[model samples]
Target: MSRTIKHEEKYQQFTIELDGDEAELAYACPSEDVVDFTHTYVPKSERGNGMAESLIEEGLKYAREHNLKVKATCPAVAKYINAHPEYKDLLAHP
Candidate 1:
């Protein structure tokens, strides 16, 4: 199923509401042009449904649009970046 992801800048997270529960990918901006993906959470019922991938994609897209490099501190986000080489260029230098 297609889901609508919402970026809540105030909360520094991307979220999707599913079956009245919310799945979120939280992030932090430590520098002017860097976005650090800090955590990802999917409701138990929402797991295995690509909710985390969707949030990661949206978060990366947002960072790209705003010309921000990415730092994937969250394991899920790091795994996604590793699996998707297309997004590797967006990673911030270590």
Candidate 2:
């Protein structure tokens, strides 16, 4: 048997940096206990580095710390939750 193939991560690694120039990722909240996860958009130049995930994670972390809930309307946010069910409870009310 002979098989050779390269393996790589399908997505970028999530990370957040509070630099003066780093994009804020457009985190938004329309109301209390509600976070609009989809509004955030990382620049194309910054794509494929999990930067979006980092931003979402950071925002959610903030909400958790502040005892606030989240409404993952953003596709990225929902994808993250899909990858991490621990955050399923954060999904917005039906």
Candidate 3:
């Protein structure tokens, strides 16, 4: 199914509406050019549909477009980054 991911800059999160529920990926910018991916939440009924991954992909695309680096603090974000080496160059290391 096609879902639209909305970037809520004021809330520092990306959200997707699915079947009357919302899935979100929260992030924080600790610096001018760094975004820390802090949390990912998908409703139990919405799980296993790759919504979280879609959220991350949208977040990463935003980061790249804005020339910001990413700090994968959320486990799901970290795992996605690990599995997708193409995004490694965008990582912000300590």
Candidate 4:
């Protein structure tokens, strides 16, 4: 099943929804050239289940599809990119 990414403005957070519950939350700082993902975390119950990686992976797919560059400031996002070399092209200044 496909998950959805939802932005909750009141909470100032982005959530990756898996079947309705939040799998992960992502916070980003946007800029003219790139979007810096400042924080990304999954609930303790969801950890070790690849939920966070799923969100980051889909987020990267969205960025590349929209021609956006990524500046992953969030340690989770940064590590995701490093491990997934295929996403390197979407990195800012890459």
Candidate 5:
């Protein structure tokens, strides 16, 4: 299925619309330069299709473009960044 990830600034989430269903990765900015990824949700029908990964990748790209550090509060996002070492530099430091 074709999918497009979009940043909803008012909601602070990256979302994908598929077949009229929505999957989103939510985040919060706790500081000027840091964005904390708080949650990810994909409907059961949309699961196992890598939609969440696409949302995370879009979020990461947003962070990079904005020059913001990322804090992966969501377990899946943390794991994704761990597996994709190239994204490690985007991690926020305490």
Candidate 6:
């Protein structure tokens, strides 16, 4: 399946549309230079298609482009970051 992801900056979300359903990676700005990835959701039928991974990747890309650090409050996001070391530098400094 083909998926197109969109970043809705106003909503602080990265979303993907699939068969009329929407999956999203939602975030909040805890500080001017920090993005907290709070949640990610994909409909049951849409799961296992790499939707969540795509959303996380897109969110990370946005963080990088804006020179923002990331706080992965969501387990899935943290897991993704752990698996992808290239994004580790984006993690917010403690």
| Per-prediction TM-score to the true structure, in the order listed | 0.95, 0.65, 0.96, 0.74, 0.94, 0.95
Candidate 6, TM-score vs. the true structure? 0.95
Number of the predicted model whose lDDT against the real structure is largest: 3
What tens digits encode model 3's per-residue C-alpha lDDT throughout 14-80? 9997778899999999999999999999999989999999999999999999999999999999999
Error of 3 at 79 (Å): 0.2
Q: List the lowest-lDDT window of 10 residues for candidate 3.
A: 16-25
| TM-score-best of 2 and 6 | 6
TM-score between candidate 2 and the true structure: 0.65
Question: lDDT of each prediction vs. the true structure?
Answer: 0.94, 0.58, 0.96, 0.73, 0.94, 0.95
Q: Residue 54 of model 2: what lDDT? A: 63
**RMSD, every candidate, angstroms:** 0.9, 11.1, 0.8, 3.2, 1.0, 0.9
lDDT value, candidate 6, whole model: 0.95
**How well is each residue in 20-83 modelled by candidate 6, as lDDT tens digits?**
8899999999999999999999999888989999999999999999999999999999999999
Show where candidate 5 strays beyond 4 Å: none
- Greater-TM-score candidate between 2 and 5: 5
Model 1, 2-91: lDDT tens digits are 989999999999999877789999999999999999999998887998889999999999998999999999999999999999999999
Top-down lDDT ranking = 3, 6, 1, 5, 4, 2
Candidate 4 Cα lDDT to native: 0.73
Error in Å for residue 44 of model 6: 0.3
Q: 10-91 in candidate 5: lDDT tens per residue?
A: 9999988767878999999999999999999999998998998989999999999999999999999999999999999999
- Give me the runs in candidate 2 sitting further than 4 Å from their true place: 1-22
lDDT (tens digit, per residue) of candidate 4 on 1-94: 4556776646645677654456654556466556667777776766887778877877777678778798887889999999989999889873
lDDT of 2 by residue, 1-94 (tens): 1111111113211233333334333445568666565455655666676666666777667667767677776677777889988777766775
Off by over 4 Å in 4: 1-3, 7-13, 18-21
Q: Which is the leading candidate under TM-score?
A: 3
